[model samples]
Target: MGVKSDIINFPVSSCLSPTDKSLEFDRDFRIRHYAGDVVYSVVGFIDKNKDTLFQDFKRLLYNSSNPVLKCMWPEGKLRINEVTKRPLTAATLFKNSMIMLVENLACKEPYYVRCIKPNEVKSPLLFEQERCRHQVEYLGLLENVRVRRAGFAYRQTYPRFLQRYLPHINHS
Candidate 1:
């Protein structure tokens, strides 16, 4: 607070003027976003801003005897003192989980098969050879099969494959 010009709090913007004399928004602050400027009251979340609320929730859920919650909040296994200097936000946690899921699935070598309807009108017992053949030709299913057969080996993106299995190799 003693550092010169190191402002502790933002000053009320000159652009923000209250319409009613009875109302006062002294504690509120104006934030400039790409869409527009908006006023926010810091009164409610000031204390919450400093606390590791999500981390606490993760730890609480981790302590539960239920297997599902313990599985979801893996970081909860870490003691309160072991958490990083800044707690990771919910979005960060979600992103990390998604990355891991993608990496794990990439190792499975799943193939995409597009099922084409026999006809447009939902008629049963209809076999459209021309339509099915056209789809297979255009979708390069034949070429894919030829290449796969020629190679006769599992193929995956190297970086993702390495990242997925590296931990297992190191640990074992």
Candidate 2:
């Protein structure tokens, strides 16, 4: 017998301030991870920040520099873009990236999966009807059914539909 365990990993960025030798913006990083855990605790931090620690991380990638930031990224000697006037901070960039991802997902089809706990004591044979009903109601399955019956349950392109079923059909 094998035990099934779900592990969630969150990528946290920490920046060391050279002046005081203390972590900068540690609380904000922890808070962001906590909030993200609430939404995707089962999915394992799907929206982890890419490079959101030091102020000059993005600049280092682009080979740009600031006099103060140069100590942190010595090789990033290229001049910052003058047209933009101000570069986006790590927090702002993370927020914008999340917004863009949400917007993109909003334009695509969505799939939902529901997981239910069997019993309070983790008994395999126990099926509690009231608990199941409460789970269903909390998940809004009834509302989904009503809305789906009122409208098209699924919409697919003609070519996609043909591609899916053509192989299964006998072409007489």
Candidate 3:
């Protein structure tokens, strides 16, 4: 029998980093909890798929220097608040982005998404109390979906790459 091509074999682009203008004072990255008032502008649609959620996800997956994107793994569970009405698991977020792809591809059904540690890219600046504050406020730390068995150790396709770029974690 001949091997068949995967229907989901979509080419991905590079993940988009936040612009300097977008970076908020005192934030590491721009993230709003589900309870937050902000709409959290995930690009719904962009023709040819550029800048859209699907492309962003695909790029975030492939372009990362981190190893997690190269393979798949099981992630822990999450629970929704019901009040905020948002997903508790990072997989849920991934699945939603995939759904956008599927729907755009004219597929009626949703595909399952599994969570791995979120890609932990650097915050894009050296630590300065003031500059870093704006950067932090603009971009709070992204959550780590995959936690290592040991509290200090981390698991993913890659290890410690993000930490390499981040400012020294103050142990004091």
Best by TM-score: 2
Q: Is candidate 1 or candidate 3 better by lDDT?
A: 1
Whole-model Cα lDDT per candidate? 0.66, 0.52, 0.38
TM-score of each: 0.33, 0.37, 0.16
For residue 5, give model 3's deviation from the true position in Å: 32
lDDT of 2 by residue, 1-172 (tens): 2111211122445553456332234232222221132212222232353333443454565453445444434323444443244554444454455556767888887877777775688799999888878777777788989989989677787899999999999878
Off by over 4 Å in 1: 1-53, 65-68, 109-172
Candidate 1 or 2, higher lDDT?
Answer: 1
Candidate 1 collision pairs? none
lDDT of 1: 0.66
Model 1: per-residue Cα lDDT at residue 146: 90
Candidate 1, residue 126: Cα displacement in angstroms equals: 24
Error of 3 at 47 (Å): 21
Backbone clash total, candidate 1: 0
> What is the C-alpha lDDT profile of model 3 across 91-127, one tens digit per residue?
4445545656567778444443432222234444433
Q: 31-118 in candidate 1: lDDT tens per residue?
A: 6542345766646443443444467788898999999778778998898788887787554465466666767897786777666666
